[model samples]
Target: MSDIPLEHVHREPDSDTGNAVFVLHGRGADEQDLLPVADRLPGDRHIVSFRAPDRLRGGYTWYDLDLSGGGLESSQPDPDGFRRSLDMVAESIDAAVDAYDLDSDSLGLLGFSQGAITSLSLVLERPDTFAWVAAHHGYLAESHADRSPDGIEGKPVFVAAGAADQIIPASRSEAAAEGMREAGADVTFGTFEGGHGIGPDELEAVQAFVEEHD
Candidate 1:
């Protein structure tokens, strides 16, 4: 869909494993930001992180945010840019699978902040693309989040957030978990003691979740 593919950084596993995880970093972050997180995962997973389509600050953005109406927690994603990134992300996953000879059925999704929002929407929009998902500190998109009728039945989703988070409050993540559950996802919502970032306990829980699915 996009003429110029999203810029990305990819790491291959030591073995010939076809399993892979598509990582998406937060707003104002690059593809490289989440590569280190992948090291905490298993050695057999191929980690690929994609740069957002637009440049913002010193990093990248999946879409513009509208905070005019309320606080940061109430900010909504600009629909046009939001939907555009969704398409690009889908394309990128397809390209990655073909380019690296990865297994489509063994795909996983990992994302944070705006990237988390994108990942959440994708699993709803294209449920079959990923086997599991991990979304940290983000909420469901406010617009154009169309879940297919059949829905993501039995899909495994891990949503972690800070209980004291002001950026995208814990309540928002709770609602996200509810949303995914309503769509038949096997959701595991993890809450850490801190605010707006993952903690060691949260990381361990996330790692365990991934390990279970992998």
Candidate 2:
């Protein structure tokens, strides 16, 4: 994975509940970008904000999905490159879980845009690594089909999208939700009033979703 360590922001759960939230940042952003979302969520949840492995310009990226150009294939994943990056991100998650002594069954991933795409890839790659995944304004890269995790049946999932989002169109969002459903995730998809970003109301829904799943 480029032999570079992905930086991360961590927030211990306010209560000793042993639950945690892993936050994945969007393109051109670092771990700090999503830390505030963690804060806005339930305080009792331990939170992790992870930077992407590749540093393009001043921020980071999960894969090459050209967020800058908005073209069809600017930053699209080249199978090999994406595999390496995904492996490192998964390894980070494993280490984070072990370091915190957290239960994998109670773990969740929260990502936005590029982060969301990475989150979906992570869940698909591991099969049963997380209890829940919250993807905000993100979609799976092409050709990645959905499948059920071996052991974690009924795995919960939350997806949020902006109706006017020009970056990752609403159609892609629906496709993502459908794909997750086909893969057997207990999916909850919501659309907001804005575009390309998460709003306060969306965060509230995310908060409620996590609490309910936990």
Local distance difference test, candidate 2: 0.78
Worst 10 residues of 1 by lDDT: 142-151
Q: After best superposition, candidate 1 residue 207: deviation in angstroms?
A: 0.7
Clashing pairs in 1: none
Q: Write the residue-wise lDDT of candidate 1 on 1-214 in tens digits.
A: 2433788888888888999999999999999888777678754878889999999999999999988768677898888899899999998899888888899999999999998999999998888888899999989876634453355998999999898998889888888888888778999997899997777898899899998887
Error (Å) of candidate 1 at residue 209 is 0.6
Best by TM-score: 1
How close to the true structure is residue 76 of candidate 1, measured as C-alpha lDDT? 87
Clashes of 1: 0
For 1-214, candidate 2 gives per-residue lDDT tens digits of 2222557777777577768888888888888998878787764777878888788789987766534545752335557667777787788888887777777777788899888888888887775778789999987676465455665356788888899998778778877888888887788999988998888889999989987886
